[model samples]
Target: MSDWLDEIHWNSDGLVPAIAQDPTSGRILMMAWMNRESLALTAAEGRAVYWSRSRNRLWRKGEESGHVQRVIELRLDCDADVVVLQVEQLGGIACHTGRESCFYRVLRDGQWATVDPVIKDPQAIYAGGHGHD
Candidate 1:
């Protein structure tokens, strides 16, 4: 297992991009970064863990909003530089902006368009505060 872990191609920043998708629905939830430690934790715990570049720390999905992702499988790309996490999403919405996915907006005809409606209100979900105590 260690040898396989070592084979992952982490970037210079010691991070890899991880894309999360719904296992049952086949919907892409979001994309995040992961370090070696985060990847290990996710594998061991059956949960999705990510390294937040903005916060400069490890973050467990749904830590705040109870929107946690339960990992079903982890896939490494051919280059081993990218990871795809098949997960069972607890919450319906995945985007911080209350959309089902982060890719709610799309650029069409050289203009940005709202491709989908907001599934939930982020403010309302986080209003009671995150799950972390």
Candidate 2:
């Protein structure tokens, strides 16, 4: 039998874009990259796991912040290149900036506008100091 991972059309870097969505609010929380191991771990663990390109390692969501995403469902786009995860975002935070989502900025009058307010102080969220995505 073919492996389920084989069905995904990974990019040249062997990574696929994964989007995390709030299952209840239907709001997009954040997006991350996933490699085969990270994707498999997410399914097996029933939580969100992603490949940290900057850290060059498997990043278990909320490992540092205690804001884990409990994945309820996983879907693949028609082209089988993108993945979406319906998740219950713990602690009501998803962005490293302590915002509800990474998409807090909107294009307004050709300028980026910050709409969503930071739910928590990033300094309180990250003990080692913020700036992680």
Candidate 3:
């Protein structure tokens, strides 16, 4: 059967690295994994859906934290081994840590430093006991 998913060069575990980017700022928000089903669902649903390796299931962005990513565009890398989603991050938060992005650390003097401040308290964001990470 002909399928668009076949074009992607998924890894042995049937997963591809997906990057989420803020279309407005062009800043990378997060990176996650996506399976065939999740990618297809993301396209159909017009949202960012990822494969949660830890949970062993599909994860719809903002499902628990109300930080949904509305996908603006989806792209495959030149190698066809990576997926990138240009998205409008809902609530302006993309990290479970309540920061704007997951890559919030800066490497300085051979050490990692957290430079981004949490816009909203994680305690307040995940008040209902939903796991963020």
Candidate 4:
């Protein structure tokens, strides 16, 4: 039943790195992991669903913060070990840090610096300690 998933070269831990990107801007938002169930659910739901390694369960994007990603397309890398999800990020937020994307830091002077301003306060986005896994 999961023949499509079997084609993916999952790591020894049974996980594949999944990247979420903005379809319009072609910007990489964040990187995550997906298991067979999550990957299948994402395809069936037309949304991004990731396997939360920290929580050891399925994590649906925007479930905690209302920044759900509507998947536009799903692509597999040449190695078949990585997945790229082209999506329209709802509410324009994809990071738990209240940033548009998780990759808001830039390497400068051999140091990491935040280049983007927080669109909203993370405290307001997440009601409790559920901000990060």
- Scored by lDDT, the top model is 2
Candidate 3, residues 1-133: lDDT per residue as tens digits? 7798999999999999999998788999999999999999999999999999999999999988888999999999999999999999999989988999999999999999999999998888899866674
TM-scores, in order shown? 0.91, 0.97, 0.96, 0.95
Each prediction's Cα lDDT score?
0.86, 0.95, 0.94, 0.92
What digit string (tens of lDDT, one per residue) describes model 4 on residues 1-133?
7588889999999999999999888889999999999999999999999999888999999998888999999999999999999999999988899988899999999999999999989989888767652
| Superposed Cα deviation of residue 51, candidate 1 (Å) | 0.3
The candidate that wins on TM-score is 2
Local lDDT at 9 for model 1: 92
Give the Cα-based TM-score of candidate 3 against the true structure.
0.96
TM-score of 1: 0.91
* Alpha-carbon deviation at 68 in model 1, angstroms: 0.4
Q: After superposition, how far is residue 28 of candidate 3 from its true place, in Å?
A: 0.3
Worst 10 residues of 2 by lDDT: 124-133
lDDT for each residue of candidate 2 in 45-100, tens digit (9 for 90 to 100) = 99999999999999989999999999999999999999999999999999999999
Task: Sort the candidates on lDDT, descending order.
Answer: 2, 3, 4, 1
Which structure is stronger by lDDT: 2 or 3?
2
Query: Which stretches in model 4 have alpha-carbon errors above 4 Å?
Result: none
1 or 2: which has the higher TM-score?
2
Error of 3 at 48 (Å): 0.6
